[model samples]
Target: MKARFEELDFQQTPMGELMLRRRTEVGTGTDIYEVKLGEEFLMSSLFTVAEEQMATLGLAAAAGDELDVLVGGLGLGYTAVTALGDPRVRSLEVIDALGVVIGWHQRKLLPVSPALVEDPRTRLRRDDFFAVVRQAPAADAPRYDVILLDVDHSPRHTLAPSHADLYTAPGLTALAEHLNDGGVFTLWSDDAPDEDFHATLASVFADTQAHVVDFDNHLTGGTSSNTVYVGIRQ
Candidate 1:
């Protein structure tokens, strides 16, 4: 049987309006992305291995004396909800540029089972991710033990082209500012980043490494693998 998709309902944002659709196979897709941001694709359900890796490995490495987390995009809220499951996590904040996507979670279109939204530990912010992260306090700054960023596609290609800047030296530097000592910054990518990009991260971070997770399930046409990069702030 062929896959099915419903027409996306749109909502406004600082960048522009974004359209999202419901897939019989997955949870939802942003029309502009043609990319599904839920499990099977983006991991809407906590059952997905990718989300599990994002939360478990990413958060575990970032954990410290006291835990706080900052997730770049809300998507299906799997990353946020999964972080909440950790007893060490004292606070969790998720920011997404598209208000409509966040609204869907509010309306329960996505099952955030751990209940991060209602949990006192979680704060959902609908704002420009760059602005939010940059302006976030440095002194009283929410020094996140973990910062899991899944904003764009990857360093090679991105869902939002403008976000290419976030992968740059300056962007990575700004991201570093939010981290407490020993904090880990992990980013999920559809493909491996160019060699120089990794070098850029190494300049700002004491330790950095890339991990690849294979997903034989073809979304568009051919087989594809995913990579996530972890950068530790010393």
Candidate 2:
């Protein structure tokens, strides 16, 4: 039997102190991995239904096979790994601002980390995803069929002030340019769907929708909800 709880790794990032931890579930004996940034919990293995749904909802919006996908955040590899599960996804590029977090995956410290590192179609890039989307893609740059973003808390709540622009019309327009015609942009928001943000997405995409995803919150003993916003590029 392994230790019931363990601190896997710790790092000081520009964002704050980041820690990866594993705890054994008492009733089920399942090992749950968790990531914490500063005083806030970023992600947990036990509550990954919404993360997986982000990729599913995004890819479902994108039309056609041989899809090239880009994931704006790579927390614990849930979003990227879920996107890769689809046989239609030809390629996947995962961009994350935190290099230390990427290192954890490369080191196989996370459960799905090995899958991400070993996957031929997946490429993990350490960079600001918002910065990548805000600029026009070079003539030779690859356009994505789907872009799944799980970086911020929501359109109104971002980790940093700099990330606020991506939720605006002009910022979304710039992101649209990085997608192929009919490409999909999906966002994972911790809050309920915002009407103003929906209007912003509608202004940028040909079609848009917000899905309220409900999941079991073990800590709360009740259901918790998150939003997945999907938009199809014109």
Per-residue alpha-carbon lDDT of model 1 for 6-122, expressed as tens digits? 544565555454555545645543222222433224433413456557777787687465698889888767777877888888888888877777777776655562486679988
lDDT of 2 by residue, 64-83 (tens): 97999999999989999999
Give the C-alpha miss distance for residue 173 in model 1, angstroms.
Answer: 1.5
**Which sections of candidate 1 miss by over 4 Å?**
1-8, 12-17, 25-48, 135-138, 218-223
lDDT of each: 0.71, 0.94
The lDDT leader among the candidates is 2
TM-score, per-candidate, Cα-based: 0.79, 0.97
Clashing pairs in 1: 38-42, 38-43, 38-44, 39-43, 39-44, 137-141
Q: Which predicted model would earn the best TM-score?
A: 2
TM-score of model 1 relative to the true fold? Answer: 0.79
- Where model 2 places Cα greater than 4 Å from the true spot, the runs are none
RMSD of 2: 0.9
